[model samples]
Target chain A: MRRLNQLCCALGLFALSAMAYAGPPVEGALEKQATNWHAIIMFCIFVALSMGITYWASSRTKSTSDFYTAGGGITGMQNGLAIAGDYMSAATLLGLTALVYGQGFDGYLYMLSFFAGWPIILFMMAERLRNLGRFTFADITSFRLDQGSVRTMAAISSLTVVCFYLIAQMVGAGQLIKLLFGLDYNIAIVGVGILMMVYVTFGGMVATTWVQIIKACMLLTGGTLAMLLAFSQFGFSFHTLMEKATAVHKLGIKLMTPGSLLADPVNAISLGLGLMFGTAGLPHILMRFFTVGDAKEARKSVLYASGIVAYFFNVIFLMGLCAILVVGTNPDFFEGGTIGGKLIGGGNMVAMHLAKAVGGDMLLGFMAAVAFATILAVVSGLALAGASAISHDLYARVIKKGKATEAAEIRVSRIATIGLGIVAILLGIAFEKQNVAFMVGLAFGVAAAGNFPVLIMSMYWKGLTTRGAIVGGYGGLLSSVAFVVLSKAVWVDVLGNKAAIFPYSQPALFAMPIAFLLIYIFSKSDSSARAKAEIEAFEDQYVRAQTGFGASTASSH
Target chain B: MSSAMYERMRGNPKFQELVATRGRFAWTLSIIVLVLFYGFVMAVAFIPGTLGQPVSEGAMLTVGVAVELFLFIFFWALSALYVKRANGKFDALTAEVIKQAQKGGK
Candidate 1:
C-alpha cells in the first residue's frame, strides 16, 4: 500500500534531497508488489468487526421495514455519520487527492462542486422525503400517481444510477486492492462483491449504517492525522507549505489557481448541475431519510452530514497540498523513480504515499484498511437501495399491487442483493482496463436528469400525472445516458474516436430542462380522468408532506 | 388522514402560514446557494485566474482557496440555520396544525 515500502526504507533519508532518479523496476506497471503485512492485518481486523456486526444484525432483520429502513429507529447523529460514510467513497480520498496532486486548484474546485449538493438536499428534499416515503424514493414519486407505471420508471432510473455508481466503486476497489494487498485484480473484485452482498442480504440497512458510521470515523481520524503530520513539516503555516509546494510542483504558481478541470463553460455548469442535483436523486442517499425517526431527525442528519463532509473536504484539500511537498519530492513514489513521472500505483495512490511519508508505515496501513472499509460500506448501501427498488417498488408495488407479504418482499430483496453483487463483480472485471472516472460523472448525470426532475415535479407540482412522469423520466434517462455516450469522455477518451458528438462532457445542463419541459407539456395536455384524479390526490399528499400527519411512523415493524 | 381533516387543515390560517413561511425560507436558502455557487462557477469560467491571485501581495494563499474555505463554512452554517428554524418553529406549528385539524374533523 505504501508503494515499495522497503525501497523507501533502503533509500533512507536520501529521499529528502528531492532529486530525480530512475525508479527500481521497469517491467510491469500494475504488477503485484510485496504483500503489505501490516495493512493486511489491519484490514482483517476491520473485516472481522464488520462481519460480527452483520451476524448480530441478521437476527433482528425480520420484516421488510427492518431490512430496508432499520425499523426507522436510527437517530439523527448516527444517520448523519452513516450518510457521510456512504457519500465519501474511496474516490473522495484517493481520486480527489490524486487530481489535486496532478491538476491542483481544479481538483479543489471539483470537490467544492460535490460539497455544494448538501445544502440543497437539506433545504429542498430531506424533510419532504422523510414525511412522504417509506422504503424507497419511488414511494414518494408514486404517492399520487399510478403506482405501476411511475414506480416502474423510478425503479429503472434508480437501478441505472446504482449500477453505474457500483461500477465506479468496484473498479476503484479492484485497482486499490491490487496495489495495497498485492492481490490479483479479479480476486479483489470478487471478494468485495461477495462481502457487500453478505452485508445487505443478511443485515440489510442496519448493518450498512453501522459500517458507514465506523468507516466515517476512521476516515476522518486517519485523514486528519495525515494532514496534521504533514503540516508540521512547514511549521503549520499555509504560506510556507504553498511556497515550498509551488517551488517543487511542475505547475509552479499555477497550482494555486483554477486550471484545466473546468475550462468549457457548458461543461463546467453542466458538471456543477450534475453534482449538485444528482445528490438529491441518488437512491442510496435518498433511502437514508427513511432510516430516521421523523422529519426532524432527517433534517438533523443532513445538518450533521453537511458539517462532517465539509470539514473532511478541507482535510482532503490540505492532504493534497501536503502530498505535493511530502510525497511528490520523493522519487520512491514514482513508477520510474522520477519526481514528475507517473505514480507507482497510478496517480490515485498519492494520499497513501503521503500517509507513509508523513505519519510513517503505521498510518499508511490504517488508511489502507479504512479505504477498504469505505468501499465495502458504500457498496452495501448501493446494494440495499438497488434491492429495495427491485423488491419494494417493482415487485411488491407494481407486480403484486402492494399486497405482497412483508416476508416475501424481504426474501426478494435478499435475492436482489446477491444478484446486484454478482453483477458488480462482473462489471468491475470487465471494465478494469477502461477509464472509470466518467462512470461516476455518468451516474450523477443520470441521477440529476433521469431521477431528480421527475422527483421534484412530483413533490411540488400538482399537475404532474403518471403519463407525464413516465415520459419525462424515461426521456431524461435516455438523453442523459445518450449525452454521455456521445460526449468527449466516452466518445473520444474511451472509444478512441476522433471527436465527440456532444461537445460538453456532462448531461445535466441540457437533460434536466428537457425533462422538466416534457413533464410540464404532457401534464398540461392530458385531459384523461386518471390525470384528473391524480391532480385531486395531490391535496392529501401535500398535507402529509408538510405536517407529517399520518406519515409512516418510526419502528413500525 | 380523512378528507374532512384535510379540508379543515387546508382552511386553517396557521396551516397556511406554516406552509408559506417554511416554503419562503427554504426557497430563499436554495436560491442563495444556487446564486452563490453558480456565481463562483461563472467567475471561474469567465475569469479563471482572478481566483488564483494572491489575497495580498507576496502572500502564498490564493483568493480562490480563501473564498472556497469561506463558502464551505458558510454553506454548513446555512444548513444549520435552516434546520434550527424548520425543526423548532415550523415543526411546532405543524404539530399544532395537526391537532387543530383533528379536533375540528372529529
Candidate 2:
C-alpha cells in the first residue's frame, strides 16, 4: 500500500511540474526546465533518516523524564544544534529568502536583528533559565508565585504562541508538500500533521531534539553550498553583482538599499522588538535548555547555537540575494510562469523558485525537501511544547497535585501531542491561503509580553508573588492576542477585510510595557511573604542545577 | 576559608577555565561578528560600485557565490574550533571535577 501510494505521488508531481511549465513565463526569467529527480530523492532520504532517528530516540524513552528531556543527557554541542534547528524554522529559511529575493537589503536587516536575538539569549537568559525550570517555562516562573495562577497563565501563553505560530508552519507544510510531492493541499496538511504527532507522541523531547539537530545540520550545509555556488556565479565580486542586480531589478535593488526600504517605521520597530525579546520567552526554545546536563552545559549549548545560527542566517541572506538575481532572469521559474502566481505574493516562495532557477531541477528539489523538513521539525517541536504544558503543567501539577506517576504522565503527554497535532493541522488549513508571516511575529510578541516578565522576575526577583506572576503573564498574553487580532495586518492582510480597531498595526509598544508594569506593581504589593519563599526556592534550585545534584526542583506537568 | 579555596580550585579548574575561555571568546566573537555583519551592511549603503567591469552577469554572479561560500566555511571552522577546545580541554577538566566531587566511596 505504501509503495503504491508513493508511485501515485510520483506521477502526480510530474503532472504538476509539466503544468507549471506550460504556463506563461514570469517576466525576466529563464524558460528551460526539467523534472528534478535528484532533488526529490534527496528530500525523501532526509525525511527517512529523520524518522529513523526519532524511532531510535523514542525506543529508549521509557519514563516521563526520558521522553520529556532525554534524562538531560544530551551533550552541549548536540543541544546547540538542536536549539539552532528549533529556532531556524521554515519561516526563517524560505520566507526570509523570498523576502530578500523580492525586497533586497531590507531583507538583510531582518536577518541581522533575528541573529542578534541569539547572543541575547545566550548571554542573558540561558543559564538562568536552566537553573530555574525543568520541562516547561512555568517551572521557573511559578516557583515564587502561586502555582495555579502561574500554570494557568503559562498555559494561555503557550497555547497562544503555539496556535499563532502553528498557522505559518502548517501552511508552509501544505504549500511545500503540494509543491514537492504534488499532493492535494488537504491531504498534505493531514499527512504532515499525522507525521508530526507520531514524531512527538512516541519519541517526546528526545525525538524532537534529534530531529531538530539533523535538520539544522542539513539546512546549514544546504544553505552554505547554495551561497557558495551563487557567489561563484558572480565571480566573487559583490560590487559587480550588486550593481548588476540593481541595474536589472531597480525596485528590488532599492529595497535592498538601506534607509528607505521599510514601508512603515512602526512595523519595523514592532518586528525588531518581537525578535529581540521573544527569543527568551519561547517555550519550545527554552525547553531545549533543560535537556543539557547542567547550567554550565546550558550556557555552552547556547554559545554553540549562536555560532551555528549566526552562520546559517548569514548564508541564508546570501541565498536570498542569489535567488532574486537568478529568478529575476528566469521567466519560467515559478508555477504558471508568473512571479506573483508562483510566489503567493510574498517573500516565502522566493528561495525555492531561486533554487530551481540557479541549480536547476536537482537543487530546487533539494531546497523544497529541506523546506518541508523544516516545517515537520518545527511543527513537532511546537506540538511537543504545547503537549508538555497541558499534560505536565495543567493535568499533573494542577489537577493531580504532582501525584501522577511517570508512566501516567508520559501517556498523557503522548495523547496531548496527538491532540495538538490535530489542532495545528486545522489551523494550518484555515490560514493556508493567507500571508501569515505576521503569525510568527504575533507568537513572538505574545511570548515577550506574557512570559518574559514573569520568567525574569521568578528567577532574579524574590518579591514576585503568585498573584503578580499570574496577572502579569495572563495579562500580557491576552492583550497581545487581542492587539494582534485587531491589528491592520491581521484584519486586512490575513482576514482580507479592513477594520480600524487600533491605529497602530503592531502592539509591542503598548503590550510589553504593560506586562512589565503589572509584574512590578503586583510583586511590590505582596513583596514581604513572596520575597522570603522565593529566595529560598531560587537558591535551592540554583545550587541543585549548578552542581548537577538532586532531582530537578523544576516540576514537569 | 582553606576548604573553600581548595574546593574552588579542585572542583573544576578545567570547567572554570572553559567557562572563562568561552566568556572571553563570546565577547570577541560578538564584536567581530557585529563588525563583519553590520560592516557589510554599512559598506553596501555607503560604498559605490566600481562600474565598467568585463565580467558577464553570470560570471559576476559566480564570483559572488564563491565569496558567500568562503564565508560559510569560515563560520564552520569557527564552530569546529570551539568544539575542539571543549572536547580536548574542557571536557577533560569537567570529568576530573566530577570525579573529585564524588561521594566518600570514590
Candidate 3:
C-alpha cells in the first residue's frame, strides 16, 4: 500500500506536468494506446550510438583536462555544431513550436531574443573567455580576485542555474517520453536520469560533445525535411502557406500580428532581458569555450553557432506556421470532433502530430526520437556543468584548497554527477505540474540576474572586489528567486493564491539592475588591501585576456 | 617575462593601437545590436500597433515580421564582418604586438 501510494504520487506529478503544457487532462486514451514501436526502435538506435561514443571517449579521458575540455582537441566547426546542439534543446524545437501554434507572432519574439544572445557572446565574451578560464567559468572570476570566496560564490550560482535548467529538461523529457512511448511518467524520469548519469560520469565532455554534434545534424535534417514537406503541401509558395494558415486559424489575420500573448509591456521586456543575457550566463555554454583550441577558434565557434541557430530558427518559424494550418485545423488531432476542445495528445505535441500529418508515422517516430535525443544531450551537458561546479570549484578548489589530485577530482565529479541526476529526477517529479517552458524562463531569469552581472562586471570592471561579487551574486540570486515565487505566474496560477505581490513573472529587468548597482557600490566603497591589490592587478589580467599570453594550453595527451 | 618587459609592451604604440581599434570595433557592433534590439523591444511595448501594420499595402507580412527577418540577416552579416576583420586585421596587429613584446623580453 505504501509503495502503491508512492507510485500514485509520482504518477500524479507526471500527469500534472504533462497536463500543464499539453492541456486538458485526457489520461485514458494516452494510457490505452500501445507503445510506439517505430519511435522505440529509433530511440534505441540513438541510445546505442551515444553509448558507443561514450565507451570510446572513456578510454581517452585520462586526466582532468580530458574529462573537462575534451583535451581541447575539438575543431572550431565541430565545437560550433556542438554549441548549437547544446542551445537548441527540445524546448526550443517543441515548446516554441507549440507557442507559435497557440500564439502566432508572439513566438517569433522568443526566437529573436534567443538568437540575440549569440551575437552578444561573440562580440563580448567568447575570445576573452577562451583566453582566461580553465576548467570552469569560476576560473575566470578567481583569476585576479580572491580565489576562495569568489569560487565558492560562482560555484553556488552555477549550481543554482544548472539545477533549474536540469529540472526543466527532465520535466520536458518525462512529458515527451510519456507522449511518444506511452511510458509511465516515473519510468521516463528515471530513464532520462540514468542515461544522463552514464554519459557525464564516464564519458564527460568528449562524449557529450560528439553526442551533441550528432544530435544537431539529426535535428537539422529532420527539421528541414519537415519544412520541405510542409512547404510542398502549398506548392512551395510562402504566400499560399500564410494564406492557408490565416484561413484556418480562428484569430485570422491577427495570427500574423504581435501582442496576443505578450500583452503586458513590462513582462515582455523582462522576458526579453532574461533570454538575451541568460545565454551568456549559462555555465554549460561558457564551458564550451574551454573545449576549443584558442580564442580564434572560440570566436569562429560562436560565428558558426549563430549562423546555424539563425537558420534553424527561421525554419522553425515556418514549421510553426505550417503546424497551425496542418495540425491545428485537422479534426483527427482533436480529442473529440469538437474544434475548440483538447488536442489528441496536448498542444506541446503539435510538432510531432504535424510530422505525422506530413510524413506519416515513420517521420513522426523519427522526430520523436530526435526530440528525446535533444533532451538527453542537453541534460548531460547541464549535469556535467553542475558536477564540475561541485567537484572542480567546490571540492577540489575550496575544500582541498587546490591540493586535490586529478584522479580524486574526477572521482568526485563522477559522484557529483550521480548525485545531481538523482536530485534532478526528484525535482522533475516535484515540478511536474509546472509549465516546463515557464520553468526554463525562470531559469534564464536567475542566470541573467545572478551569473551574468558578476561575470560581466568581473571581466570589465576593475573595481570588482571578492566581497562585491559575492554580495551582488547573492543579491541577484535571492531577489530573482524571491520575485519569481512572488510573481503572478507562480503565486496566483501555480500556488492557487488570491493575487501575486510581484506583477511580472520575469525578474531580470529589476533584479539585474539591482545586482549591478550592488556590485558597483560595494566595489567602489571597498578599501581593504586585498581589494586594492585586485584593482592593481586588473591591467595585467586585461592584457592577458586580450593577448592570450600565459593562457592554458591544450595537452598533447 | 619580467615586469619591465610587460611595461614596455604595455607602453608600445602598436599594442595601444591594437587595443584601441579592437575595443572601438567591438563596442560599435555591441551598441548597434543594443539599439536595434532594444528599439524593437520598446516599440513592441509602447506602439505595437505600428509594428502590427503590414509592411506594404495589400501585403500579408506585418512590419514586425519583415523588420525582424531583416534584423536576423543583418546580425549574421555583422558577425561575419567582425570575424573577417578579427581574423585578418586584428590578428595581424596582435601578432605584431606579441612579437615586439617577445623581442623586448629577450
TM-scores of the candidates are 0.95, 0.79, 0.94
Top candidate on lDDT is 1
Q: Where is the poorest 10-residue window by lDDT in model 2 chain A?
A: A25-34
Residue B50, model 1: Cα distance from true site in angstroms = 2.1
Candidate 3 chain B least-lDDT 10 residues:
B1-10
Q: In model 1, which regions exceed 4 Å deviation?
A: A1-33
Please report how far candidate 3 places residue B5 from its true position, in Å.
5.2
The models' CA-based lDDT, in order, is 0.89, 0.69, 0.85
What's the ranking of the predictions by lDDT, best on top?
A: 1, 3, 2
Model 2, B1-106: lDDT tens digits are 3234235434455546655675576456545544554444344344413111223563433222333345445544554555465445655655565455553223
Q: After superposition, how far is residue B59 of candidate 1 from its true place, in Å?
A: 1.5
For residues A338-419, write the lDDT of model 2, one tens digit per residue.
6435543234567766666567677777777787778889988888889989988998888888899988898899888888
Superposition error at A20 for model 2 (Å): 18
What ranges in model 2 sit over 4 Å off? A1-40, A252-256, A259-266, A334-347, A494-499, A527-532, A535-557, B1-106
Deviating ranges (above 4 Å) for candidate 3? A1-27, A31-33, B2-5
